[model samples]
Target: MDRTFTEHLLQWYDANRRDLPWRSNPEPYGVWISEIMAQQTQMERVVAYWRRWMERYPDLGSLAAASEEEVLKVWEGLGYYSRAKNIRKAAELILTDHAGVFPDEIKQIQALPGIGAYTAGAIASIAFNKVAPAVDANVLRVFARLLDIAEPVKAAKVKQEVEQAVLPLIPEKRPGDFNQALMEFGAMICSKRPDCDQCPMSQHCAAFANGTTGERPVLPRKRKAIHIEMATGVLVYNDKVLIQKRKPDDVWPGLWEFPGGCVEKGETPREALVREYMEEVELEIYPAEKITVVSYSYTKYRVTMHCYLCHSANNGQLKPVFNEAVTGQFVSPESLSSYAFPAGHRRLIECMLDEAWFDNLK
Candidate 1:
């Protein structure tokens, strides 16, 4: 363990750390929540979401008692809905298994539903002040450059090497602060474009000294963007729309959505919506006016979702008799917020609300 490197990192952190709420008053639950929220989300965005979440479900008891839909609704717009689901699941497990206390040991933390090695380390070290190494994407990048590692940092074997390297460097005293400093340093200074001038430990960075910082943290090439055409129908009967819960095996699984499916080859968006409704929910509907077209990207998939206002073709007989395989409901416009919807669907709702489209339901 290089004492100087640890010294420089913690010194910089003490001077320039972000004054986040979780840091001001550190605790297991709040720190764990913040770490989870920070995954794949901007720090600023996580801050607002985390604050709102803490206010509503402050303790494990509140979170464990909350309904799945309520948890999903609170976590809406964060994407990775599974993480939110896992958080609630883990909370319940803690209540039952750990007596409602977030585990302080690294192994116990890692055993929780969504807590991987990186997250486990973060929560254990930062929250409980356990002497554990926190190796996130930022830490990986920082170390890859520091050690001049040429292999892809994301490779499983390489990640293990990096994680092990940081282990011995975690000072026993204020270990949590040390881990946070490394994460913060990597995020603010040793980022993709290294701010060497601002970096406290620049002298120890092998890539910087060797002038190979740009190429040190080798990353895999990004996946090609796949374009998908989808159609969804808002089956209106009065002020209510028929919505269905997605199958657990489907993409964006278990979320509520307007009944729809992908536009197969050569099929029009209108035809796809009508066909999907019949197949999924046994509803024969005529696709009416186009409500809105939504364009969004998730992971490597780019979706062009054509949303439409639809009406029953069964001569105004709107009784939806769902079969054994389907789950659906016709809910009023004001009640849509009670369930969580995908970001694109939520945006479509925004458009629906703006024009009061429910007024046109026949």
Candidate 2:
């Protein structure tokens, strides 16, 4: 790679970089939080979450002391709840293992939960001025185009080559600025549909010269989304809805949802709901009329949920048998506002509200 590319990119970045909140005062804690939130999330959407999160737990000590419920509550709408959990765990480790100080060394930072190579490199270079490369998808795209490499960008071998290519370009005195500049450049000028006409690195980009900017960064083939059909029972007894708390290790840990599971083959939605309630809470339910259906997309699968209004088969005599991993409770319709629920369950709650079912309860 030409040395002029780094100089020109830095100049462009100094003039054109977005005035992000994390950029205002780049501290290790704040940058770490921002990086974690920014993963698989857009920058525009993350700004407000980052601001509110910083306000709630301003330092490592506060985050370390917070309960999982409190942490998940603050991170309610932020998908990938595990990131929030990992951040809290990392905070606690920093406090106890590292004596409440954000470690400046890349290895030490990487030792924390959820701190992978990309995140560790970002924190090290951006916050600590270490000569490290932060090779995220943006950087990968940039590097692939700059050198006009055709290897799959997501491949491990390609990533290793990109990291090596970027290492030599890191300026000794301003490694952080250079690293951030590369990321910012890729984000703004060298995107998937790059603006080559306005790009400062257009003259230096081999893909642009070769007229292959759009095709150089080869991505892995996408897997088809698996379609899943599910049924959930919204059991309302004596004006209280029965909800189950997910196991800590489950997908949406600690979140409340109507008791049910995926619909099995060769079974009706109603039958699935009855069986699910029995399996999940050990309570027999008489599945009633279909209340609503909701569709949601997860990372690997698309789910269509069939929700039904249900009643206890024993005429309210059956109480939920709480196991060690999962628990259940009956909550008033109005009180449901206080609990956090998955997106699909939240939609179910909205449907019940829209139909005024809770208002008609005797």
Tens-digit per-residue lDDT, 28-82, candidate 1: 9999999999999989999999999999998999999999889999999999988
> Candidate 1: lDDT over CA atoms?
0.88
lDDT of 2 at 171: 90
Clashes in model 1: which pairs? none
Model 2 — which ten-residue stretch has the worst lDDT? 316-325
Against the true structure, what is each candidate's TM-score? 0.95, 0.93
Q: Which residues of candidate 1, in runs, are more than 4 Å off? A: 321-326
- Candidate 2 has a TM-score of 0.93
Instruction: For candidate 2, write residues 1-362 as lDDT tens digits.
Output: 76787899889999999999998889999999999998988888789999999999999999999898788878877788889989999999999899999999999999999999999999999999999999999999998998899988988999999999999999989888898898888788888888888877888889999999889799888999999999998787887888878898888988888888888999989888888777777788887778889999879989999988888887646678755237778889998877778888988988989998788664
* Clash number by candidate, in order: 0, 0
